[model samples]
Target: MTTTRICVDPVTRIEGHLRIDCDIRDGQVVDAWSSGQMWRGIETILTGRDPRDAWLYTQRICGVCTTVHAIASVRAVEDALALEIPLNAQLIRNLIVAAHGIHDHLVHFYHLSALDWVDVVSALKADPMATERLAQGLSDWPNNNARYFAEVQSRVGKFVASGQLGIFAHGYWGHAAMRLPPEANLMAVAHYLEAMDYQRKSNQITAILGGKTPHIQNLAVGGVANAINPDEQSALNMERLAYLKTLMDELQGFVRRVYLPDVIVIAALYADWLPYGAGVMNYLSVPDFPRDTKGTDFGMPGGYIPAADLTQFHAVKHFGDPYFEQNVKESIKHSWYKGDWTRSPYDGETVPEYTDFQQDAAYSWVKSPSFADEPAQVGPLANVLAGVASGHAGTIGYLNTALERIGAITGSPVPMAALHSSLGRHLARCVRTQVLYDMMVENYQALVANIAAGDTTSFNPPTFPKGEQMGYGFHEAPRGVLSHWVVIENGKIKNYQAVVPSTWNAGPRNQNDARGPYEASLIGNPILEEERPLEVLRTVHSFDPCLACAIHLHDNARQTIVRVNAF
Candidate 1:
């Protein structure tokens, strides 16, 4: 059998380090594996510490999504302590989660994942005038190149002239998947640069509120530590709100004016991609923005989209609520841990053994988190699906529109299967961004009214007076369903285990011989070359992986004695 090796020395524009390996045949990847060689033990480090301090330690797991981790940890601690935050606390927590959603989505689409699909080299030939027309046709916005797209043209020309297409190094330059005209590519390229600056400003909302980006300090179990009075609340009033509002506008603009159109453009070019790279039919999501009283009471605000073989969607319900208790569990059969191999998260246990590369000893510190004893796809797809199933206001309508768009592109109704690829993942993220923007607006209005009625305290620190209890805190983080399980004894952490978004998506095969989401998604992808494996990148980017947060290095030694003797 003839084989072509497809490889990517270093996947660019991702948060952490990983190299893609694929075994290819006939220009398609039939098999693939993602390798990460870095390791640090935050989980082990935090062992035996006070349960109250777990949030502080977890927040440092990753700099990019620290706030999300902190929120999960605090909520988990709160659950364990059986602490009910003040109403104001709920509102603040909601805002922090919302802010993280917006920031993470923007960063994913523009900075971390865009290059995989967008071609920087293509922009060099774009005719600026035509781009302006396309933008005008797409929407009526005041782009710096609104009336004229030439300003971008000049700079892009220089970058290309300099013979340094830094961002396009691994881009499938002439791949069949590229479809946007040079002009449209030009528009996207310019906005790609502009988005970097705009997204940074969007981050300030988190910075001012949380204390910093990547990880914030304002959130706690009881509620936010940062107090917001009338003046502090003013930050979300007109000016700050308007700035946030601008981001929404820009985000929508990019989706419509650039991202969607580019997707269609590429889809048209790679019609064959319509059938390949679909992973397991199982889909699971933990929704956000619950409107109903029942939905609110239980933190489970989303639905679980099962694999194709599974039946209808099921509500994940809140962590504190007893409703979603049926679906969550962790399996250790294939994992390194030797403790109870299979256990319900409600009684989950985490006892880390030292790092050993032996497949059984402990290949990765990440534990396998299964919903219904199976791996489930998380992230944008899960968010959208869960939101719709949870009776989230307007979710169905939004979904219908997305489905229609996918249908039109593929000439077949977009199946749940389509939601597993690079294009599907990117498109799903854009749709979710719109959903999050609206949710933030709704919460912002609610916060204003709550403050008007005379409630100001957003937190209520607890004493853990009883000094022993267990709490399960769950939320849909940027990556997917994130949960914290805590066991408190004498007010200190007796045991802890986290079912993070990445662990669900990135974990290895389970005891029953099942592939994780990433592995399954890589199946059927055509491997192109050993030197540049595009399929591995496809699956990796599809998850918008934040391995840095889930939390992976190298060693070279010198031999001096023999060398000195030879010399």
Candidate 2:
């Protein structure tokens, strides 16, 4: 058998720099490697900084998930102090998280990964009226009209006729793998534009409560800085709350009617993908959206599943659970770091020793993160599986709805087990979005009700003691389980580390040579074309790879570049 090496450098349509190398044999990927081309050293920058200011700095780690890092950092400090935030603070943070997730997931599916399945060139050939009818059949979204689709089709036609593909430049436009019909492609193209408006509305929810998007300003050590006064005009007043509710309403409508239907339709069209991209079956996710101030009860459940065996599942009862904390370690065996030993994240070190890519040696900047001595995948799919396995009502309801819809479209009963593939990751995101839409509304109502009952407190001041103290914060973010570990000594951050979602999924092999989720998923994937590795991109994008968050950026002093594009 002749083996060929296919290298995809700077994988497009993702956050940071990544290069995927796969060895193809007999037209299928026999082996693969996921490399983070840049090294992220944000953790090293946090040494000797004020613990309270860590969130502001750490959030800069990724422009895409700024709010998530901010929330996680503050929560870690609060955990170290053993502080309990006020209920209003809890509600406010929950709303920000839910809203950010809505925006992130929406942009991820439509803007980042949709083109992998949607054919823009084909869409130009679709009849505008037929596309409108297709959209109407999928959902009752009011944008389902002949005029709206015609406008979208015309825009697409102009883009193609201009001979400038722009973002669509490197796409496998006419690949044999492209399966969707021209009419379906047109419908997706229309929703893709409308998604931009919906995502903006979702971001407004974050901005209203957090004072800004990307990086929020309201988070403090103990709680949020958002003032809660029902009548006060300058603070978080009733008027602002009403406006927030309106934004939430619009966002929810888009997710339910537009986003959910699109995912189901796409999944149905590519039902053959159900068996591929089933990477490391082991899953991990932490509970999010605390219902109380102490973070005791959660709106979402978290747990671990080793080897895809749901029967041997273990629930993560609370923050800093022994099973999670003690078992979490980062191995530098295949990373461009000094050490080869796997140590707990609290004691983790990031000493860079860069050497050009070596297939058998260090290849990535991301340290392999393992839970319970095993590589586990963390993301929406993990969260959904954990919730469904643990019988969490919200997760169960959402999963059922997604399975039923996908099944109805494919003319077959989509079992729960089918949710272990590339399509499953996409479906899980839509399911998680549905659960978050309701959670956003529920948390918002709780905030209003609490304020009406003469309780307007939002922040609780946190105090740090002398000597060394260490703690961790966990959140089931839009991508999956995101945790920040902190070591505070005498009111300063002694050390800091963030085990981000991308790190878990895109990291390299461990000490035992066990492949990471991205590498493992590509093992048996059919490479339809060597030059156009659309199948590889589909699997990688399914993880929504954000190497910027997983590994820090590379700053080059001599290079000056400017990008300008017309959409």
Alpha-carbon TM-score of each model against the true structure: 0.86, 0.97
| Per-residue lDDT of model 2, residues 313-421, tens digit only | 7988776677778888889999999978898889999889888898799999989999988899999999998888888788788778877877888899998878899
Instruction: Output the worst ten-in-a-row residue range by lDDT, candidate 1.
Output: 552-561
Candidate 1 residues lying further than 4 Å off, grouped into runs, are: 3-10, 144-148, 166-172, 175-177, 231-272, 290-300, 309-311, 323-326, 332-340, 344-365, 391-393, 405-417, 552-567
User: What TM-score, to 2 decimals, does candidate 1 have?
Assistant: 0.86
Best candidate, TM-score-wise?
2
Predicted candidate 1 versus true structure: per-residue lDDT over 417-493, tens digit per residue: 56556566666677676666666667767766787777777777787765568777777887787877777778777
Colliding residue pairs in candidate 2: 40-552
Residue 16 alpha-carbon offset, candidate 2, angstroms: 0.6
